[model samples]
Target: MTELPPKPSRDELTERAARVRLLAFDVDGVLTDGGLYYGDGGEVMKRFDVKDGHGLVMARLAGLRTAILTARSSSIVEVRGRELGLAAVLQGRKNKAAGFRELLSQLEVSPEECAYMGDDVNDLGPLGMAGLSACPADAAAEVRQSVHYVARCRGGHGAARELVELCLRASGRWEATVQHMRDPDALQAVKL
Candidate 1:
């Protein structure tokens, strides 16, 4: 794990989180452990966190749009996004900030209503532009410095889930989300 800077106050975190309508992520170091594994057949192999996927589901249930913006294109990510029902999954994007802007336009949202999580310098542009910026504990030094929140958990180890939980809690929907998960039928009855 990397050394983390001081975290913002809970009030501040919740304040920023409350304004978020869309939450986007960077795929590599944010969702995975940043390990690139290539098979003999040239197949790209990546490990995804089930917890992160669940978090995305919960985010959707809470009425927040979720997206994935990655520089590297991968079929695995595409499948994962589909499984989680993400609003967008943009791969092979050289300019993540530009991609995020396009996503905002498509969703009819503003930067002030977007939250982004990333783990490298490549993510700085989106982080700077987002209303709430977050990163995992093991994120790059510069990324840690730039983010508003640095999760205690490392990447690929429930870090994304942690961010999602923060958003739910800040929006005063965590408990209800938990309850909804317990009673799937009841969740269907209530409108998100």
Candidate 2:
């Protein structure tokens, strides 16, 4: 049998993580509570964490890009992504790696400049390619073992916030990013 290439070690991951300019995540388990509800008319629904929304907003404020990829389509996710001004929103993507590559190419960014957070098998491919891969605390054993960081929170319960904070702090942009958000005069200050 042919030998496969070895995966990047944790130290290499940490060094490369400082260069990340984009942070993307898988939907469902990564963004939502992983619970789907079908109403009487068969309309589907999923709950997104508001703190996760704030995290994405903070990442955007730091001049880092943010996006979402979902294997199954959801109008709720679409609306939330648009509301958050995420740079890319990919849906119905069976091959997450393909979606990730397409988004990176579309954004004109390198994989070494990106991070990914995921929670399941479907998310593994993209996670594997990111400079710093993270997973929710409750992610599958294989997924947690494969990632560089395992969030303290579970999915849809501030997990995104935990990862976003980790990435921002790792890059030394978290304090600036939060201050920018807290100051309503920040944008106006830029104009003066």
Candidate 3:
């Protein structure tokens, strides 16, 4: 077996994260632990972490755009994206790099200002192109090796939250964002 490439140093990772204005995620392995469940009626079920949802909100509050790019189509993912107020939710995309490019163009964001979180081979193209990249602790070795940061938490267990927090902190927005979240008036000002 070949040795995996080393992760970037903390300072380097932080520097890259600080430049991010957009964050894109792969829905399965990066957000839902890569699990798939089906009911008798052929409905698909996926579990998502509330912390991750809050993290997306925090990113948006801090003036960052969030997007979901997934190969599989799921109504659950659509509802989740809406609930979290993500900028884009693109599904049924077999070629993720193309989808990612389309998302960037649609949002008018450059690749150097985007962060991507993924956990599988399908995620490699976007991850490699992103300004800052991250993966879950349980990600594939290749995926893990390619990213700048690997979260201690697994997917569906706050991994996405970890990535978002890293970027927020690096860019010096976390403190003010948290303060705003705590302010009842500030929270009430935003209509859900």
Candidate 4:
């Protein structure tokens, strides 16, 4: 097996993260532990972490656009996207690089302004194009090797939250976001 490059230092990550205006993610393994639960009627279900959901909210509050690109189509994903007020929720996009390009066009942001997190080989395209790439701890070997950052937490267990926090802190938006959480009116007073 070939050795991967060393992970970026905190300062390097912070510099890259500071330029991010959008936060994009892959659904399976990155957000939902790559599990597919089937019901008796053949319905599919997935588990999402509440903390991750809140992290998306925080990202939004901090003025970052959020999106999800998944190869599989699921109504659950749509619901979650809507609940989080995501700017985009693209599903059934097997060619993720194309999808990511479309997303960037739709949002009018450059690749250098986006931070992408993914977990498998399928996610490599967008991960390569993103300014700052990340993966969950449970990600595939190739994916972990490809990304700039790897969270300590596994998928569906605050991995997304960890990334969100890193972006917010790196960009110097976390303090105000926390203040806003403490007092909703506090956000209005602080300049982002």
lDDT of 3 by residue, 18-116 (tens): 999999999897788788988999888998887888888889999988999999998889889988889999999899999999999999999989999
- Candidate 3 deviant stretches above 4 angstroms: 1-5, 188-192
For each of the candidates, give the backbone clash count: 0, 0, 0, 0
What do the candidate models score in CA lDDT, each in turn?
Answer: 0.88, 0.84, 0.89, 0.90
Better candidate number, 2 or 3, judged by TM-score: 3
Please, what is the TM-score per model?
Answer: 0.91, 0.88, 0.93, 0.93
- Model 1: residues with Cα > 4 Å off, grouped in runs: 1-8, 184-192
Which regions of candidate 2 are displaced past 4 Å? 1-14, 184-192
| Highest lDDT model number | 4
Q: Per-residue lDDT tens digits of candidate 2, residues 1-192?
A: 544345556666556667889899888887888999999999999988888888888888788899998789888888888888899998998899999999899899888788899999888899889877888998987788788788899999999888788778878998888777778775443311
lDDT (tens digit, per residue) of candidate 1 on 142-166: 9999799999988888899999999
Predicted model with the maximum TM-score: 3
Per-residue lDDT, model 3, residue 83, is: 80
In the range 69-99, model 4's lDDT, one tens digit per residue, is: 8999999999999888899999999999999
Residue 163, candidate 2: C-alpha displacement in angstroms: 1.3
For model 1, name the residue pairs that clash: none
Prediction 3 global C-alpha lDDT: 0.89
Better structure of 2 and 3 per lDDT: 3
